[model samples]
Target chain A: DQQVKQNSPSLSVQEGRISILNCDYTNSMFDYFLWYKKYPAEGPTFLISISSIKDKNEDGRFTVFLNKSAKHLSLHIVPSQPGDSAVYFCAYRGSTLGRLYFGRGTQLTVWP
Target chain B: EAGVVQSPRYKIIEKKQPVAFWCNPISGHNTLYWYRQNLGQGPELLIRYENEEAVDDSQLPKDRFSAERLKGVDSTLKIQPAELGDSAVYLCASRLTGVADTQYFGPGTRLTVL
Candidate 1:
């Protein structure tokens, strides 16, 4: 069973618009959630993260919202740019062993 | 500082052959992890090491896979008699001990077993 899931396989948006990616998890033991952006031929790079204690975390144009009760989270990019087009993955940091469980990922395309 | 480094960006071999992928983590990082990412899937952890000791390898297929981290800085993962299902991208990540749970990843080695 997949503990984390990204139901949307891809999302496309226009430049200067908002891009929202959704993710859900079944495990309650996950306390830390993070977003990673990956480009072609490159490894994933860390983006914004939100702890269980906070409902939202923002970094520049990226914002992540967490709804612990519903076991859902979403990453929002405001005024998305072309460079932001890539595969976005959501990960949960397991309480035990400190390992991360990742979602399949969402391919985001920001058009000019 | 240089990010994690992985060699053999791409490899193609017939089924039942042996293949190996190498990784060099960032300097002074004590925690290293190896993950396998199949097509259209996210990365799954195969093994984890704290320094030279392998702390977790429950997901690794020991029957045909082996890994070693000799000096706690660089690691090598080998698959002997690789099967067609073994085709995937192998990623290496490292993190400093006691730091935030962020992991720095390498470019990854894409392996295709024909």
Candidate 2:
């Protein structure tokens, strides 16, 4: 069973525009959420994370908003650059531990 | 600090052949994890180890797959009589402590079964 889901398979955005990616989860026990960026043939790298208590977290040009009641979260990247064009994965950490459950990933293409 | 290290970035083996992948975690890290990632999908945990003890391995296919972290440091994952379905990227990650810690990932070893 896929506990985390990224409904959108792909997204295209123009350079310097805002890019939004969404994720949904089925488990309520997850307390920590993380975003990862991946390039082809490479392992994912941690981008940003948020604690369950917070509804929104921002890191420079990236921001993550969580809605516990809806079991959903989103990542927004502003002034999207060509370098930001990669697969974005949303993952959740276990309540007791840091084990992660990941979504299928969304491929974002930023056209310059 | 050096990140997790994995050897043999790419491998291609025939079905029924034996294949092995090696990993060396970051220095001073005590928690190690193994994960399998399929194309276009997210990674799934294969096993987790604390020091030299395996704490979780429920997702591992024990029939033909086995792993060992003998010295509480470097690890090896082996598959015997490999199958086509086993083709995927195997990633190794290391954390400084228990589950709540952040994990650092390696480049991963991609296996292609012919």
Candidate 3:
């Protein structure tokens, strides 16, 4: 049973364009959500996150939107750069506290 | 500060062999977790420890998988008589004890069973 899902396996966009990655979850108990970026042969690094209480959170060029009613969230990278090319995983922290449920991940490629 | 550290970046072994992966969490971190990630899939939590105590291990396959955190700072995961289906990446992550604290992940150990 996959609690979190990222239907899109890959995405392509031109540099300086907008890149959006979507994620959905089944469990409503999840209160906090985060996005992690991973490179080849490296561990995932924290990108951005949004709490269920808020609808949107923004950090510079990266923004995360949370729709609690739909159990969905999305990461938006404005003016995407070639350096942004990597696998992005969306994770959720439920009421369980320390554990995180991760999605399959989406590979985003930005072409210059 | 340094991130989580894991050894044996890659390992290849035949079926029925025993293998082990080790992880060292970040300094001052109290929560450590072990995960298994299959190809084209997300990482699945195998076990989680708070200090020296395992808080959650429901997903662990106890029959063949075993784990330990002796000093509450480092951890080890072992697979006995590994099967071909055991080919996957083993990841270890750590975080400070709190709500919504970010988890720092290790480079991961890739295991291939022939």
Among these predicted structures, which one has the highest lDDT?
Answer: 1
Where does candidate 3 stray beyond 4 Å? none
Q: Which candidate, 1 or 2, would have the higher TM-score against the true structure?
A: 1
lDDT of 2 by residue, B1-114 (tens): 888999899999999999999999999999989999998799888999999998888889999999999999999999998999999999999888844456788999999999
Worst 10 residues of 2 chain B by lDDT: B96-105
TM-score of chain A, every prediction, order shown: 0.97, 0.96, 0.97
Model 1 lDDT tens row, B18-104: 999999999999999999999999999999999999998999999999999998889999999999999999999999979878999
Worst 10 residues of 1 chain A by lDDT: A92-101
Best by DockQ: 3
The best-first sequence of candidates by DockQ reads 3, 1, 2
- Number of the top candidate by TM-score? 1
lDDT of 2 at B2: 86
TM-score of chain B of each: 0.99, 0.97, 0.97
Shift of residue A45 alpha carbon in model 3, Å: 1.2
- Candidate 2 backbone overlaps, count: 1
Residue B84 shift from truth in candidate 2, angstroms: 0.9
What local lDDT score does residue B31 receive in model 2, on the 0 to 100 scale? 90
DockQ-based CAPRI category assigned to the predicted complex of candidate 3: high
Per-model DockQ = 0.85, 0.74, 0.86
Model 2 bad stretches (over 4 Å)? B98-100
lDDT of 3 by residue, B1-114 (tens): 898999999999999999999999999999999999899888888999999999999999999999999989899999998999999999999998875478999999999999
